[model samples]
Target: MADRILTEEEKAAQERRGAAGGAQRGGPPHMRLGQPTEKSQNFGPSARRLLGLMAPDKVLVWAAMAFALVSVALTALGPKILGRATDLIFSGLFSKQIPANVTQEQAVEGMRAQGETKLADMLAAMEHIRPGQGVDFTAVRNVLLLALALYAVSSLLSWTQARIIVRVVNTAVYRLRRDVQAKLGRLPLSYFDSQPRGELLSRVTNDIDNIAQSLQQTLSQLLTSALTVIAMLAMMFYVSPLLAIIALVTIPISIGITAFIGKRSQVKFVQQWKSTGEVNSIVEESFTGHELVKVFGRRDEVGARFQAVNEELRDATFGAQFISGLIMPMMMFVGNLNYVIIAVVGGLRVASGSMSIGDVQAFIQYSRQFTQPLTQVASMANLMQSGVASAERVFEVLDAPEQTPDPAHPETLVDPHGRVSFEDVSFSYTPDRPLIEHLNLCVEPGQTVAIVGPTGAGKTTLVNLIMRFYEVDGGRITLDGKDITDLTRDNLRSQIGMVLQDTWLFGGTIRDNIAYGRPDASEEDILEAARATYVDRFVHSLPEGYDTVLDSEAGNISAGEKQLLTIARAFISDPALLILDEATSSVDTRTELLVQQAMANLRQDRTSFVIAHRLSTIRDADLILVMEDGRIVEQGSHAELLERGGAFARLYAAQFAGALTEDAEAGQGAVPRGVPVH
Candidate 1:
């Protein structure tokens, strides 16, 4: 039969047994309830720290900025060149002796009068005129060539700037991902236990990618647009300050609109990211527990729950993007209005002869060039804000406090003789309630110590304390006269080996799993360890023997075989202290016997602690301690405990009463009702 799942009543009964045992060991209540749905809102410090990571690449960044300036300068210069050419053409056309508008006969008469006047003036000053005084085509050609050169240079500079921006952004993203991964690795195990794996994965993958994308767009567009606008505006004012002022009126209005939309968009984008994490967490949990859902026939319900989260994410993202999208169009609208105003005013100025037609044309062109980049800058605000949000998420993990290492001057433990002792050890999961209270216990090396009690009797807590998974609240646990707290955690744990009931195997071949505990172990040593744990039989039964690859978590293997493999792993460690908590509970009677025999061989010279629910397994233990609550209620040999007729005797009787009666009926030797098996 499968081992019974511990009920609340059974757990309480075991606690009572530990209490009656007079030596108590306790622990925090197990947390079986689902975690609550809440999100954190701590992005300020994380943002600051993320910005600091960019300090090293400032030089290349500045160089990119310089190229951007040159590109903008040339872009603005293009319109001024057209304006100058327009002025030259307009001057030549308007200088003729003709009215702004006239009939054909009047235009002909005017042209004939102007030609006669021009010929008379030429006759009067013909001697003063020289051949070299005609138009200079060379100078005109030089100016056109300069304009072409400027266009080419601007295109090259813009391309180089884009390349540099992309390079910098990608490099920064690479470093950020690396730092985030490293930080996750250093975080305490408790943090992982408390947080959802999907949430963490989302932060590393989705959030970082968002930041990278935003950085890519924001970096290139924002820098290029800002520089272009500045250069364009300068040229605009140089052509006609009045027209430039008229167009400049749009700047403040555009800024105000952008700022308002950007602020609201940032809030929505944060919500979007939070919703994404929630959806990811739900999906991850559903996929991981697909078997459970299938067994319970709740696939539709699960799908509905996932759909709810997915819809929430979709709504949030749409809201954020929609709001951010408004900035560009609004800026463009204001820009077009300013463009009309500049054109009207400049046209009047040119008509009144206050400015040349070329100046009006150039001013209009410069206004358009300036407004285009301004609109681009306004649009990029959303990308910049999104990147900032991602940076905040990434930095959150990087800034979290790491697990503190032991002090530099830790006391060394030498030649530990495995005399385990807990002196006044106390602990709690929460400050309000204590789990263990002034607990004490002692066991010598080479002793077979059996810890018996109901579920949650603090049996596992006691072992966790020895391994330093957590530090004691108010006392010390010593091994061989050395305080465990004084030794490095790694050093303390290195001396112990454990085999838990839940065996986990990474995806690999059978030989890899067996050799994990001692990577350098020879084939003979691995075989010996496997033999000691009787793992060889199951391993050899596989079609490919040791070369067979196990499924993820070793799901392809039987529970009993997996348990045996774990035992083989611990046996290979050859630790001074060994712990077996429900180690053989999953196996059948025959497999249990084999495992028990192998365990007996492996524990011959080591200090072993066995926690068994089956009374028969601990019947031959050198010392059996019955626990109630968190204390030992009885301690003695199996026979001595039976003679006491206490908790141990009652437990033994409950497990094997039918067998004892059968033996009695068969006329074989049988002990009394309260007598323990020996």
Candidate 2:
């Protein structure tokens, strides 16, 4: 089958989709970052996993459920007891409180006419009561006292449920976080390299917090709502099945209305957020590039676009909110329609002597209870989805494939001479899209070897292989005749040291940052490392000396000084092999000279690999390797390569020729001082 060419728009959309997937791995924060994850849960699976989290502590979960059931049941019972009190008060008024000659309504009207405080109180007591043969204050008082007790018991049980569930939620979240942290250590470096830190951070912090809060707050409400619905329906049926069916009619109608409105509102919400984000981007660009806009004479165009975006955003926001807001009132209207039907029909039943007024009152309260929970659940559906999404994100980390396993019987390097070799190793960031292939190299013990190339020539990739940051797809790498993969990563890495271009320093004292690799390092050991790396000079220059704290950015210190601190950190580790990738790339010539001298001293008795863009630093290496496309194009000392007039010779001429020419013109220096720092 012939593959059809994609349209430009289709191709662009595919690229955007790819970018979005990449963003989830690691990306810059969007204003409403949570919005995507909130709606992104595999709802069915995540909800099952969430419930499963509670299953381990079955005792607490069951206890909480039991208490929740009791609380809601008592709450349901309260309305029925209240209806009985109304009946009792009416009976008492008709029999004992009202004048024999007066109608019940007339007595109430007379009391209002007199406006006597005591008489008004007597009238109010029998306002809904009807005349009866006798009244029983004893039974009424007993019923009221029982209600008070049930209410108290309900409150206590509800509080107990809250207390227990909160503990369970806390414990679950704690374990979840612990599992994530442990999983991070086991994850392959490729996972982190491909993904963004923001995604992981959100999972670790925001997502977990959402799950915890939702479980604590939503779960209790969800349980109570469920029980309330059940109890209300049961009470309604017992009072009268005909009215219960009428109340039941409202359920599907309310749900249907909610689902319809909810679906439309969700669409509007997505559009609104998209429009809002566009507006934000426009506003941000307007301010950030104000000077450019003015220079280009496009202020009016910018203003016109901003107005259009703002108008669209306003329309969407209003539309979404209006539709979502309709749920409550539409539900209320349906409820009221049900209420009017129940009251009218029950009154007729009472007149027919088939039902009592108290039962009608009780049934009305039961109907409210039934509808209230449905309304609450409808409102909470979004929150539940948001919570489930968070759980899935957290679980994603826990479920990621870990690093490749070490050999069952691993080899060990007893006295590592740091003789490193790569034999026909192959690997790629993407499958079949080879970044490095069939590459081979070797370094002798105590040899200072330099690998230099243009950007993307696989110099750093080679170093990464030597350090085993990623496992090679084929062939092997070895240290002192032992296969690197046959040894555990910790053991392999313990023998190697690396200084990368990017300097990472956390928030801590300068001393702490320097001693990060060896926390138990003695002051003497730290000072020795610092003095060797020329970090002592800067540390002492600060008023706080070594105690000076570095911020997360480490902006208080110069970039060169921060780089030196990292060199000191590596020095403190005292590994058998060293890999320096642009170690002095950030420093000035003078500072670079100082670092070179320190590095020269450090590499005296250890095998070292240096990856440099600058040719001047590594001319004196025992061997020089020129790399292109993951293969060595030339291998020799400086003189040999210059004589051969190959890739390395051309590279050398392009970079250091001016320095050598300048030195020659001054008649004070020659050969670009290529050999040693001092």
Clashing pairs in 2: 25-195, 25-196, 26-196, 90-129
Residues 1-678 of candidate 1: C-alpha lDDT, one tens digit per residue: 011123223346435633542111123333211122233244345445555666678888889999999888887788677666655444333324334354334543554577754333322221212222333345446667777889999999999999998888888889888988778655644344445667678889998998888878777887888887888878877877888788888888987998888878877777787678777876887788789989999899778877887887798789888999999999889988998898889767654546766678878888888888778877776776666776666666776667656768888765666789989988765577566788878999889899888766676667767777656788899988888877887777777877877677889998888888778889998999998888888877789998889988688888888888877877887778888787788778887888788888878888888888887788778898887766778899888898888898888877777888899899996766556665
User: Over the stretch 240-281, how does candidate 2's per-residue lDDT look in tens digits?
Assistant: 999898778888898799778776665555455445545655
The positional error of residue 198 in candidate 1, measured at the CA in angstroms, is 1.9
Q: What is the lDDT of residue 196 in candidate 2?
A: 38
TM-score of 2: 0.80
